[model samples]
Target chain A: MNKTTNQDPVVVRNPTPSWRAILLCVLASMGSAAWAGTPLRVCYVDDRSGVAADTGIQSFNGFQIAVSEINDAGGINGQKVEVVSYDGKTDPQLTATFASRCAEDDGALAIVGGNPSAPAAAMIPVASEYEIPYLMLSAGTDNLTDMPAPFHFRVGPRNAQDAAAIAELIARQGFKRVALINNSLPFGTDSAHATEAALKTSGVPVVIQQTYDINATDLSPQIGRLRSANPDVIVVFPYAADGARVLRTLQQQGISLPRIVARSALLNTLRELAGDASDGVLVPNTVDMQRPDVKKFFDSYKTRFGEAQPTMYPVLGYDAAKMFLQAIADPAVQKALAADELADARVAIRDALIRNGNYQGLQGHAGATYQFGPDRHHGPPDQNWFVFVQVADKGKHLVAADLATFKPGS
Target chain B: MKSLNTARSMLAGPALILLVGALVPLLLTSGFHLRLVTIICIYTILCTGFNLLYGYAGQISMGQQGFFALGAYAFTLLMSAGNWSFWSALPAALLICAGVALLIGIPLLRLRSHYLAMATLCFGLVFAGIASRWIEFTGGTAGMMVPSVKFSGHIVSRTELYYAILLIMVLVLVMQNFIVSTHMGRALMSLRGDETAAQSLGVNVTAWKLRIFILSSVLAGLAGIASAVVNRQVNPSFSEFPILVSILTIAVVGGLGTRYGALLGACVVVIAPQGLAAFGESETIIYGVCLLLFLMFMPHGLSGLIPKLFGRIRRKAASPAPGVVKAGEIKP
Candidate 1:
C-alpha cells in the first residue's frame, strides 16, 4: 500500500542567467547581502556540459530548486541566496579556475561542487587556500575528506562507506566466496580497493579481483575470468553505463552469479540499459525511494526538471545545499551577515559548518545523521548512509534487502 | 636598417602584450584573476611550443599533452612524495620530458603526416591511461595536490609566482624569435615548405626533426609545471585527448606560421571562455560560435592578420589622395 500526500510539485519560472545581477529591494525582514549590501553569494561549480553532464545538470537543478524554494519562503534568516554557477565542462583545470573565481571574484560565502573526485581534487586546494567551506554533492574518494581539511565536507557516502556496506551485506548473505571487479575510474578504483580491503578484514576470501578499463566493449574476458574463479557473488564498482555493459556481458556469457554494485549503478540509466539483466543486481544506495520526503523531492525535481526519472545526484545536491543553508542560518553567521562583514561572514560560515553536529539530511538512509567537526570532516562518513537495494523487474521495482537476514540466493 | 625595422616589427606585438601582462597583477589583485592570467601564460608557452612543432615545423604530433602530464606528475611527485626542492624538481621534470621525447622522436620522426599524428596520439592516450592506472604515483583520476613552492627558504607568494610565470612567458617569446632568426630557423622554414628541397640542401631531416621535437616537448613540460603550480594540483585530465584537441585548436587559431601566433591564440583560447562564463549553459555554444567565426573569416589566424591590417591602415592614412589632407593632417 502506497501512502500519498498532497504537497505540490516545484514550480519553475523563466530561465534567468545567474551571473552577477544587482540585488533588488528586499523587505527589511529578509536579510540583505553581506559586505556589499548585495544578495548573499554562493558559487555552484558544477560539471554541467561534459561527459558527466547528466549528473551535473541534475545536481544543479536540485541545488537551484532548493535556492528557489528557500527564496519562495523567505530566504535564510531573510537574506536571499544567490548561486553564481559555472559549467566546469568536466575539466579539472577549468574547475580549479572556476573555484578560484568563486572565491575571489564572486565573493561567495560558501562554495559547493565536485561529484567525481577529479574536480573535487582540484577544488580541495582552492578551498583550503581561500578558506572557503566546500561541500561535495557526491564523491566516493576517501582522501577528499582527509583530516586537517577543515573546510572540506561531503554529503554522500565515502568509498569506505560503500565498500563497508556492501562487504557487510555480502558477509551477511553468507556467501563463502566473493569476486570484486571495478572499472578504472577514481570512484571505481578507490571503491574496489576499499571493498577488497573490507572483505579481507572481515575474513571473507575474495576469489578473484579484476579491474576493467572504462568503456571497454567486450567484458566477456573479465566475465570469463570471473566465472573461472567461480565466485558465488560478484561485487562491481562502476558507473551506470558501464555497469549495464557488465550486466550485458555477463548475460551474454550466461553467468548468473548474483552481483552487488556501488551507488553509481543505481543511476536511472542502469535500469534502462540493464533491463532484465538488472533483476537481482544489488546496489549500495544512498537514498531510499519509499521515503515521503524523497517522494516530495522527486516530485519537485520532476516539476522543475521536466523528467520523472532522475538519478541519486539531485538528492545529493539537495541535502548538501540544505546543510549549507542550515549552517548559514546559525545566529553567529546571521550576525556577520547583518553587520555586512563579508570576510567575517565567510569565516563564520566555515566555523559554523565544522561545528555541525547531527545534521539529518535527505541523502542518507533512515536515521543517518552527520556530525561534522574537526575529526569527522566527511559530512556523514558512517556506513549507515548507504542501504542495500536489489534491482527487481529491470529497475522498475526495488526489493530492499534486510542486512540482518539477507539470504544468499534470494 | 631594413633588417632592424623587421626585427622591431617582430618585437612590437609581443613587447606590448608582455608590458600589459606584467601590469595585470597590479591592476587586478584578485586570486581568481591572477590564476586565470597564469593559465593564459602557461597556454602561451604550450601554444608556442606546439606552434614550433606543428605550425612551423609541419609536424602534427599530438604528443605534447603526454609530455605535459609527465612533467606535472614528475615534478609533483618529486616535491610532495620525494621531498625534493623546487629548484631541483623543475629541471628534473623538464629533463625527463626531453629525454622521453628524444627516445620517441627517433622512430616517430620517420613516419610522415597522419601516421605520425596517429602514433603520437596513441602515445598521449597511453600516457593518460598509465597516469590513471598507476594510481600510486599519479593518484589515478583524482589527481595529486602540489605543495606550495618554496625556493631556498622563502615561500613564493601568488603575486611572485605570477610575475615569475610572466617572465617565463616573455622568455619563451624571445626564444621563439631567437629560433626564427637563427640559420636553423631558415632550415626549419625550408623543411616546412619542402622537406625534399631541404634534404637536397643538406639539412639532416631526421636529426633536425628530432631536435625540434625534443625542444617542443621541453617547452610543453615547462608549461605543464607552470600549470601544476598555478592550479596547485595535477590530474590525468591534463593528458586527456581533449586537452590535445584544445592545444591544437589554440595553435591553428593563432595561425600556424606567424611570429606571435601563440600569444594571440593563448589569449583567445584561455580568456574568451572565462568572459562567457556569465552566460551559464550557453557559454559553450557562444564559445563554439566565436571559434567558428574565427575559422570562417580569419583563415590567416589572428597573429598573421592583425599586422597586415594595421599596415594597410597606416599606408592609406599616409597616402591620402595627392592633395587632400586626412583627419589630423595639416595642409600648407
Candidate 2:
C-alpha cells in the first residue's frame, strides 16, 4: 500500500496537433491580427496624486484633448499617438524614475509635463541621458534655460520675463518707489531678483523687499512693513493659495494700496479663497481669455472635462502638447519616423522644434508667440506674453488694464 | 558544542541574506526595479543608523534627512565646483557630516523626548532653507547636477552601483551585529530602558547618546552620498519634510529594537509604495490603511512578532503526549 501510494502516476502525453489544426490556428491568428501601424508612444509625467494634483489633472485633461483631436484628424504620419502617463506624486525622485521608465520601458518618442520646478529640473538630466525631447509645461524657473539643455524646451513664461514685464509696467506708470513681497521659495526669490534687476535698470527705486514662508497663513507683518515703506505699488510673487492669504490679510488689516501679482495669482481658486477681498488686485497673465482661439479652446475643454471654468495651467498643457505634436508632424520628423530610425527621428524633431521661429500657439491670444533657436530653448523670451488685468466685480471678472492709460500718482 | 551552535546561527542569517541578494538581480529584469533595490539598500543603511540612535540609544532624531542632504550637497559641491574626484569627495562629505552632527548633538542630546524632536525638526527646516536661499553656493533650490561616478577609469553602470550599495549594506549589517554584541551596546540598551538607573549603574548616558547620534548622522551622510552618486544630482528638497517622515515611519514599522528591523522596514517603506503605485491616487490611502493595521495588531512591529511565533511552534514540537513517562521524572 505504501509503494502504491508513493508511486507516480503513469505519464500520458497527448499527441501533437495535426497539420490541418496547426494550419487552422495559424490562419485564425493571421485573421485576428488587425494591421494598425505602430503607435507613436509619448510619456506624460506629472504630480497626479499629491498637493499639485489639481494642476496635474488639468494638464492630463488638456493632453488627452490634444491626443484625441490629433487621432480624430489623422495622427502623425498615419500612426496613432498613444500616451503613457506616470504619476510622480510631486516627488523629484519619483519623477526622475518615471522619466527613465518612460524612456527605457515605454519607448516614448518624447516626454512632457513636470508642473513644478523641482521635478522639471529633475527631468532634465534623465531626458538628456536618454536623448529624448522634454517639453516642460508649467515650471517657469529661469535656471532651466540658464544651462545648455539641448533636448529641453519650456512653454510657460519665465519668472524673469514676467518680472521684466511688471518692471516695464511700473516704469511706464512712472512709479518712483516699489515694495516687493514674495514667498521664500525659489519661485519667489528668482522673481524678486528679476524684478529688482529690471527696476534698477529702469531707474525705479525699490523701497522694500519682504519674503514670507511658502504656506504662511498670516501676512500682516509683511503687509505692515510694505505699508510703512509706503511705495507707490506692491508686487507679490506667490501661488494662488498664499496669494489669497496675503490678499485676505491685507483686507483685514485695512492696508489698501495698488497691488500687483504674478500670473499664478490670477487663478480662480485665489478669488474663491479670498472671496471679495481679491477685488482690485492686478495680475500679469500670460493668456488672454478674451481671444477667439482661446475661447474656442476653453469651450472644447469645458465640453470634454465638464468644467464650466478652466484655469491657466490646462491652457499651458494644451500649448505644450500642441507644440510637441507640431514638431512630430514636421516633414523631416515624419520621414525619420517612417524609416523606423527612432534616434534619428528624435534628433530631427529636436532640430525642427529649435528651427521653429515666430510660431503662433494657443497662448498667442495673450500676445505670446513661440520662437526657438539653437541657442534659445525657452519660448517667448521677451515680455510679449504678459497682459495686465484688474480683478473686479468681487473677483468674478478680469478687466484688461493698460499702464499707459494711468497717470503716475493718480 | 555550544560554540559550534553559536557559529552556525551566526553564519546562517548572513548566508541567507547573501543568497537572497545574489538572486534578486537574476530574478528582476527591469532596470527600474534594480534601481529601486539600490535605493532600498541606501535607505537600509540610513535606517540602521537611525535604529541604533532611536531604538537602542533612546534618542529621537527627526532630522536624519538633514544629514542626508548635507552629505549629498557636500559631495556634489566637492565633485562639481571643487573638481574633486568622487572617491575623495565621498569620505570628505562623510567627515563633514560627522563634524556637523557632533556640533549639533553636543547641544541637542541634552534635550529629552518631544523637545529633542522639535529641535531636530527645526534643524531640518533650517537646512532646507539654507539650501534654497544660499543661491550662490547651493544653486538656490534649482539643484546642482552631479558628475558621473568614475572609478578605475570606467563609469559605474546601474548594476555595478546596485552591487556596490549591496556590499555596503552587508558590511553595515556585520558592523551592527558586532556593536549589538558588545558591552557598549548593553549600556546603550540600558540607557534606553531607564536613563537615571543606567546612569546609577555607571553608564555614561550623555556620552553614549551623543556618540550614537554622531554615528547615526554619519551613516545618513554615507547614504546621502550614495544617493547623489546614483541619481547624479543633489537638491535642497533632499532634506524636505516628507523624507523625515519616511525615515521615522520606516523606523517605527521595522520593529525599533531588533537588529533586522531596519532592513525589513526599509523594504516595506520603499518597495510597498511602488507596488501600490498601480492603484493611482488611492495608493496613499491603501498604504495608510496597511500601516494602521500593522500598528494596531502587531504593535511591536513585524520583527517583534517573529520570536513569539517561532516559540509557539517550537513548544508544540517539543511537548510529549499525556501519560507518557519521562526518563528523569516519576509518574504522579
Candidate 3:
C-alpha cells in the first residue's frame, strides 16, 4: 500500500476539468441567479409576545405588509429584501440582546421597530455600537433624538412637537385654564413637560397636573383632583387602555369639562373601552384618512388584515418601512450597494434620507411629512403636524374640529 | 489517599465551571455572545444570593428584583449626579441595599411561606412604581443612561468586563463554599428544614434569617450594579415582574441546597432563551414546557440529580461481577 501511494502521486497531482464538470458549474451559477436573488437582510425587533403584544403585533403586521408589497414590486434593485424579526417582549435588555444578534450574527443591514420609548432608547446604544441604522416607528419620546444619535432616525412625531401643537389647539379653542393628567411612564412625563412648557409659552395657565400609573385600573382620585381644579379643558397623555380608564373615571364623577388627549388615545380599542365616555374627547390627528392616497392605503390595509379599519399604529409602521425602503432606493445608496461597499452604503442611505428633505408620505395629508437632516433626526418638520378631532356619535365617529375658524394669533 | 480523593472531589465542580467560563471568550468572539456570558455571570451572582436565602434560609423573596433595581438606580445616580467613581458607587450601592434589606427584613421576614412571598411581591411592585413615577431622579419609565465603568483612565472593554464579572462571581462562589462548609451554613440549613425546631436548638433563627437576607440583598445589589455597568443603562422595568420571575425561576431550576446549583441554573436560564430564540413567539411556550418537565421529573433540580446519577454509575462500575466472588472476598 505504501508503494501504491508513492506511485499514485501523478494521479493526485492534477485533474483537468472535464466538459461535464464545466457544464455543471455553468448550470449551478445560472440556477443560483434564477432561483435566489441576492437578499438584503433587515432586522425587525419589537415586543411581540409580552405586555405590548397588541401594539407590537399590529406594527409587525404593517411591517410585514410593506415587506410583501416591496417584494412584490421586484424588491430593492431586484435584490430580494428579507426581514429577520425577533420578539423583544418590550424588555430593554432583551431588545438590546436581539439587536446585537441581528447586527452581528444575522448581518442585518438595518433595524426597525421599537414600539415603546424604553426599547427604542435601548436600541440607540446598540445602533451606535453596531454602526447600523435604526428607524423609530411608534415611540414618540423626544429623548431618542435629543442626543447626537447619528444612526437613529424617527418616523413618529416628537412628544414635544405633538404637545406644543395640542397646546396651540387649546389656545385656539379659547380654553384658558388647562388641567393636565399624564401617565407616569416616560412618554407621558415627556409629553407633560412639553405641554407645560408650551402652555407656559402661550400664557395659558395649567390649573392642575396629576399622574397615574401606566396600568392603574382606578383613576378616580386623579379625576377627582382634576374636577376640583375645574379647568375649562383637561389634556391627558396616556395610551388607549389607561386613557379609556381616565375618561370613564371622569364620566363617573360627572365632570363635563372638555377633554383633549394624545393621538394614542384615539385608538379604536380606547373608543371601545371608553364607550360613551369617549364621545366628545378631542385627539390630535396626524393622518387624514379621508385623503385619496391615505384612503387607498387604509383600504389596502383593511383588506390585508381582514378588518373594517386600520389604526394609526399600523400606518406608522407602514410609513416607517416605506421610508427605509425609499432611502435605500436612492441612487447614491444603490450605487454604493452595487459597488459592494456595505458600510459605505449604510452611511449613504442615512445621508440620502437627510438630503431628501420634505419627502411626501401617507401622513402628509394631515400635515405630517417625513424629513431628515444633520440637525433634525425627527420626522415631520411641520410644527402643526396635528389637527384636532372630536369623537362623536357615541364613540363611533370622529369629526374634524374647526381649527380654520379660530385665528392662531387671536 | 481518602483525603486526596475528597480534595479532588471538592475542587472538581468549581474547576470545571471555571474552565467552561474561561473557555467562552476563546470559543466565541462575537460581542453578542460576550454580552450574554457577562449577563450570565451577573445572573450567577444573583442566583447564588437567591439560593442562600431561599434554598438554605427557607425564605422566598419575590422582591429580589426590587433590590436589583435599587442598586442599579443608586449606582447610576451616584455616578452621574453625585460624580462618584465606579468603585465608590459599587460599594455604596451594595451598602444601601444591605441597609434597606435590614430594615425591611426586620419586619418583613417575620411572615412565613406564602405570606412572606406576598410581602416581597408587594415590595417589588412598590419599588417599580416609585422608580417609574419619580421622574425627576429616576428618569421614570424612559430609563436612564449609565456611565461606563472606568478604571485607570480607560473604559473597560467587553473582554475586561467578562474577566471582572468572572472574578467577582468566582469570589462569590468561594465565599458561598466557605459559608456552606461552616456552622453558620448548618444553622441556615436547619432553619430551612424547620424554623421552630431550629429555634429550640439554640440557633438564633431570626438573626440568622436576617443575616442571610442582608447578604442576599447585597449580592443582588452587586449583580445589579454589574449589570448596569455592563449594559450601560438602567430602567424601572429592571425591577418589574419579569426580572422577579427570572430570579425565582433560575433559583428553582438550579437546585435548592447545592453551592454550584446557582452557576448551573444561571447557565440554563440565560442561555436557553437565546438558544431557543429562533422559535420566535412560540419560544415562550417551549421554554415553559421545558421548565414544567424539569420540575415534574427532576424535583431536586438539575444540580441535585448529578450526584445520584454519578453514585449509581460508580456503584455499577465497581460491582461489574456481582454473582462472582474474588479469591479474597467472602460470598454472601
Q: Score candidate 3 by TM-score against the native.
A: 0.86
By DockQ, the better pick of 1 and 3 is 1
TM-score each candidate. 0.89, 0.89, 0.86
Residue pairs with clashing backbones, model 2? none
> Which candidate number has the best TM-score?
1
Task: Chain A only: give the TM-score of model 1.
Answer: 0.86
lDDT of 1: 0.78
Report the error of model 1 at residue A191, Å: 2.6
CA shift of B125, model 2, Å: 1.1
Which is better, 1 or 2, measured by TM-score?
A: 1
Model 3 ranges with Cα > 4 A deviation: A1-38, A183-190, A213-231, A253-257, A308-310, A335-341, A364-368, A390-410, B1-10, B152-154, B311-332
Q: In candidate 3, what are the lDDT values of residues B112-146, reduced to their tens digit?
A: 99999999889888888888768778876667888
Which of 1 and 3 is ahead in TM-score?
1
> Cα miss at A397, model 1 (Å)?
5.6
Q: Report per-prediction Cα RMSD to one decimal.
A: 6.1, 9.2, 9.5
CAPRI grade of model 1: acceptable
Docking class of 3: acceptable
Give lDDT tens digits, candidate 1, residues B25-98: 66554565567678778988988888888777888888889998889998999999988889889999999999
List candidate 1 stretches off by more than 4 Å. A1-35, A307-311, A392-410, B151-153, B311-332
Q: Among all windows of ten consecutive residues in candidate 2 chain A, which has the lowest summed lDDT?
A: A1-10
Window of ten residues with lowest summed lDDT in model 1 chain B: B25-34
